[model samples]
Target: MAQDVLESPLVLLDEVRAGLQGGTMVPYLGPGISALREQEAPMAPEALADFFASKTTLPKRARGNPWAAAQYIESYRFRDTVTLWMQEAFAAPVPPSPFHLWLAGLSLPLIVDTWYAGEMRAALAGQSDWAEVQGITRAGIGEDRWFRFYDEEGTSIDADQAAKARTLLYTPHGCIVPEANFLISDADYVEVLTEIDIQTPIPEEVRQRRTGMSFVFLGCHFHDQLLRTYARQVMKRSSDHHYIVVDPETLTRNERRFLDEQGIIAIDMPLAEAIERLLT
Candidate 1:
């Protein structure tokens, strides 16, 4: 990642400022953020998910759909096996990147990310006070339990005990928490979809943070409806306050429609450039 491009002089800084000063900006991060590490480590959950799906038989129609492919494989009673794979892959400690560090340093009101490796807390370390909420899944003999991971200390705490106190790092998707266990399959997604609906009883704290907030989606890919559906967990489907950064060439029609219908705006730019603007 070119930290230089991520410096100031961003074309979108004015727009980002509008969201910030208005008290509506919430940063939504994703797997591509970790890939930004480039040379340090490879903690991309998409790749991990791909590795699991590759070992099993994915339905023909689900060729490019990882979650769907996993669901197809789960139908064969191998979900637990897949969970184990996730556990081992996500258990290691992967350091947060400069982008993560800068974001955490800001101590923004709300930060939402889908990087299930639990790296945000570490990224926010020593910068400001922080709380983390991760949706974790544990598999039993024949069942899976979906629960939230909210520990005051979060994966770690850093030097500046004072500034480090007030940030909230959230992972809306299921994490491996212990290893090889996560929310995978059509059934798991159904639960997530329901959990984010209007009637679902989400935590008062989470609800409070998400309500009345505008969003800046960075390094995210809403390629699947399930993912777009998942976004509802953060903001309403009809919300126009949310904005996603994208590489225009890769943005498909369905992707644009899903975002548009939900009132989410798309900004065409590479992730690094977008992140830089937001930071500025």
Candidate 2:
């Protein structure tokens, strides 16, 4: 770990804007984006349904607070049914939020995130300019196709269009398409932490687009040990750019010191609000 050599914390957003003006900007997303849009409370995903169910099971005395009870029940237990009920409940074509729109306006050639490919693809497709730029993810082949890491191994090669898609969205957790393959279980997470290197280019492809862009990490928890491995790779591979991370909660002393050591720019603020501030 090396010192960050930070100029100032408050000016991170301005620094990002200036950095982007120099070249394309990459937006790397995390779970917080989905959680926020879903209006999930600050609780673990598995606990939600049970918590709500318990509340709804309350006696008549608690019926006056039916909204809270209903919310708990709906949020907690819906996972089992989301696959079948989400479309009717929330609709599939829901447009991206203002923050997402702003992100697409950057016109970056690459959009890499750890979130589900569907939401981010929807966001990018919603943008006029970005719509022309096909999305390549580990998800599907429509607008966003998976990176097809298997492509690297010489199994599934990319067609001319896929190889040249304006935007390549790679998610380590896998994608929705080709079945629910995104990494979630403990074993899957361990595999991601141990395998997969995004820094190096696959055979025949120009070494994973390294230059001409800055990475803006949003809603990342940095808790995954593998994430640190990725960070280390980026830090070691490049010396010409900076990486920005946004989290509304202020960083802890240890975390700050670690980031400072690594030269990572950590912004203290919620993702949506921070993007708003930067755009303005």
Candidate 3:
């Protein structure tokens, strides 16, 4: 089908809702989703970069880049300092949004959260059928592993154990809870990015669950190349048709191109408005 024919917001919302109820649409959440909460958690990359800069002096080139700022801190102060900052930045509790609660009720095979906050885990706390698979940084660990699995109680588990859960929460960028595992600095991503295209870093459970599923991208922006690349690789081998709720007027040229290239239908509306309609 042509992109123009699928540009109807009402029609797209109906399809997305149906997909959610039917368990074929995975929710791909971004950091901006944290903005729905009243509390502050440095939701955006730029905001996080600024937060790091505030704590330590960063060169002008790394001012607004979270990865660069983190790299600078890791190089100068040490990796422990970077982890401390991340833990402090996300220490405050952020209540889950309505969408999170709605999703928690469903029997989703997989949910990809690309941020470090613990709200998603909190939202799923009421359920016992879920587990988390997060990307781990290769800085200090002597083990040759790229990811870790944790059951609802946050105890470390094997991949076989995680695969048995009805719902799997995949955090590609790591989270603050359970353990302070973050992939923010330049060195952290160097290994993951190198193998992401080949699906080496992605867990087997995630890859199998996402095989024939569609994705509903919420609170996501693809203006940066790194963001675009991660989205592309994560959704690789999934169903062709996907939906991204975005304000058409605010899309960057690169973002628009990415949507077109990825067979994603852009629903033009505010995030809150779209979420409201999705719930209805």
Work out the TM-score per prediction.
Answer: 0.77, 0.59, 0.97
Q: Write down the lDDT of every candidate, Cα atoms only.
A: 0.61, 0.46, 0.90
**Candidate 2 Cα outliers beyond 4 Å, as residue runs:** 1-10, 40-95, 127-160, 177-179, 189-207, 231-236, 245-254
Q: Write the per-residue lDDT of candidate 2 for residues 140-243, one digit (tens) a residue.
A: 23533323532221234344534464445454444443233333333333334443365322221223444445567776656435456554553344344555
Steric clashes per prediction? 14, 16, 0
Per-model root-mean-square deviation over C-alphas: 6.2, 9.1, 1.4
Residue 181 alpha-carbon offset, candidate 3, angstroms: 0.8
What does candidate 1's lDDT look like per residue over 36-115, in tens digits? Answer: 76523235545754665556666676566656666766677576665655565566677776777777767587778776
Tens-digit lDDT track for model 3 on 131-198? 99999999999988999999999999999999999999999899998998999999999888999989
The candidate that achieves the highest TM-score relative to the unseen native structure = 3
User: In candidate 3, which residue pairs get closer than 3 Å at backbone N, Cα or C atoms, i.e. clash?
Assistant: none
Question: How far off is model 1, as Cα RMSD?
Answer: 6.2
Error of 3 at 204 (Å): 0.8
